[model samples]
Target: MLEISPAIKNLEKEDIADNLLHYVYNTKHLLSLIKKGIDLDDPSYLSSYRSFEGEVYENFIYEKLLRYAEENDYITKFVLKGFHQGKCKAYANTLSISEKEQIVYRTKSREISEFDAMFLTKNNELYFVEMTLVKSVLKLRRRLRKKKALLEIIFPNYTIKSLIILNEGATGAKQFPSYCKVWFTKEFSAAEVLEYITKLDKQKLLPKDKINSKKMIEAHMLKLHPFRYYNTMSWITKTIRANKKYVIDMNFLMTEKVQRYHDLYNKFYVGFLTVKEMKNILHLKEGEYSEEQRVVVALEKKHSDEIVVTYYIQTTRKNLYLYSFNDAKVVKEKKDPYGITVTEVFHINKLMNESYLLSISQVNTIKKLLKERFKRESQKPNEK
Candidate 1:
């Protein structure tokens, strides 16, 4: 008798099992086949075994998602409804909590489509995930749109969310549906992906007036490993104390030292800012700043506070822009010993600059600083 996991029993009929078998067969003689004239590394071979590779990749993603749904606290809120490889029939049998079907079929279009994985929460939100190893999203766009339409028709009441997980970074990512979130496995780990999917976006931050200095400082001091505000401040202060001859404004010194530390250690200085500071950085008059203000205001309104606005300054030659993100969904908000409300972690959902305002030259003197930093970084010796 063959044993199947209760969680994945419903998926046994899907192509994941077939994909695994194919993967094993392909991998078994892969080395010998490579030595014998078949160059698996060649792009030409993609058509032959790429399906197996893709299926295996999809299975890997499904497993990771399954693990998260079982183990992670944040992911626990979501229940893995089912996994379907290509096509499946709509089942009347409903999960204990919700009466919704995991898969849907349309008789008019006569199309049987399904996402690689699907999840649901008690609140009637549906998450559909697709995994691909392809480098471009062009071919996948039509299928995604079709699947979106199918799901919308079946689950009209639920808020449907789509996630596309790519084996690596791809081109034409912008071409995907605006509502869809794309993640590159090469850029993000399974844990990071889980954190993103289950992040808390509905939690509103305390209003700016209600926010205290301690809360503000805590937001700014949000760590990015190896570097934090206090650590940078201490280093700059000690260096200044030792060298009384070097004179610089405290604000200027902090900026210079932060950049210096980043260049030296290849670590980014991750910090948070308020909407007011962001507007002040642009330093535009009412009419002039209106466009940027809209982006900032919309983001601030989503989180209901500027405490969620996070930015990281990277001084490395490769990283050019001052990347920032808003809509940082917090895990939990609680009062600390000081009676100040604080968030444990700010899991960023989207990089604002990619789709919004941070790239503008006038914002934070980006254009001037980009040139200066690039020139300075170019002059340095290769990092050890």
Candidate 2:
């Protein structure tokens, strides 16, 4: 007897089953046969094996599981690789919780196990699942318990439930122990699974005290990891701490660092510096600074000249300020004529320094000012 979901009737009316089967037999079969070196062109060869076609049939079954779960209101997410050990695998999986942390768990060291699926309810209760195409109820129950133990270790805070779904006639559903639930073809429908999960009242599942404790732990973990504020924020923190004994001004340090970076970054400049040298010049402590940020700054310089030309750029809610030396007053000021007018060019560099001089045009302007100053002084004596 063919065991099918009542929802399968809905799918049948639309000829979705025929289309799905067609997809299954053609692309799925051809790919599987090609792997085994079976003669696909021979009609007799195709006729002899009219039923199962190995992994291809397994893939089609997984797809059907996904379609059934989605149609029945389970929100599904899949992890094809990196999330588990062994060869890469696909999971037609579902999660029911809204917790900020990962509810599903898998370890790479467990060689025999390919993947583990988890469904968490809003109340902090969870179901740990291990699926097998094998029809044996005994084998399924054993594997399901193993998965539950693994998840208990991974998610210590949440209560764990266990479930196993196996092929029909593999074992009687009664074989499963009372503590665990076994779903056979006739007893459990995709709709029932979806309804059971969706109807779970999260408020009842998650106690306020547990949620609060989880939140506190999460907050402390975030502080340790510390979200990347600026690209160089980590470097800044480490460098500042390493030299904490010295009275260092952040603004002054940033200005000098940004200017030095600009000089090294601009390849056309006379004092071209390598990334290693730039790191040392910035007074960076060990691996505090990332080469990634420096590479990005270098690439920006490669594409445009504007980034290398600016200095001491700062932004407020309303406006931006560029600091440069005014030879006329012999002092640095908040505004300079050569400063960038457009706000979009704003960027942070770790090498902008006092010793850094402007480009050739800026140099000429200062020399011209000095010449005029000398001329004014000479005329004053003549007038006297």
Top lDDT model? 1
CA lDDT, every model vs. true structure: 0.39, 0.34
Over 4 Å off, model 2: 1-5, 8-58, 68-112, 130-133, 186-384
Q: What is the C-alpha RMSD of each candidate to the true structure, in Å?
A: 22.7, 25.6
**Candidate 2, position 258, lDDT:** 37
Question: For residues 1-384, what per-residue lDDT tens digits would candidate 2 score against the true structure?
Answer: 113465432222232232222221233453355457878566744543333332223333334433443343332222221111123232112211112122232212112123333343445554544444444456555455445543443355766675455455665567565545554432222332223333546223221111111111111111111112222332443343234333222233335443333232221111112234434333335764344322111111222112221222233422433322333322223443333221222333333232222334443443354345445645664431
Give lDDT tens digits, candidate 1, residues 1-384: 112233332223232232222212234333344446776577645454565456556655665555445443333133333221212333221111111323333222222454566665445556677788788877687566556644554455766678777754578887776668776665322232223323566333232111111111111121112223223433443342233332222234236434343222222212233334445443324553223222221111011111122233222212222223423332212223221001111112122222223333333343244445456655789562
Once model 2 is optimally superposed onto the true structure by TM-score, how far is the C-alpha of residue 150 displaced, in angstroms? 0.2
Clashes of each: 0, 15
Task: Give the Å error, residue 315, model 2.
Answer: 68
Give me the displacement of residue 63 in model 2, in angstroms: 3.0
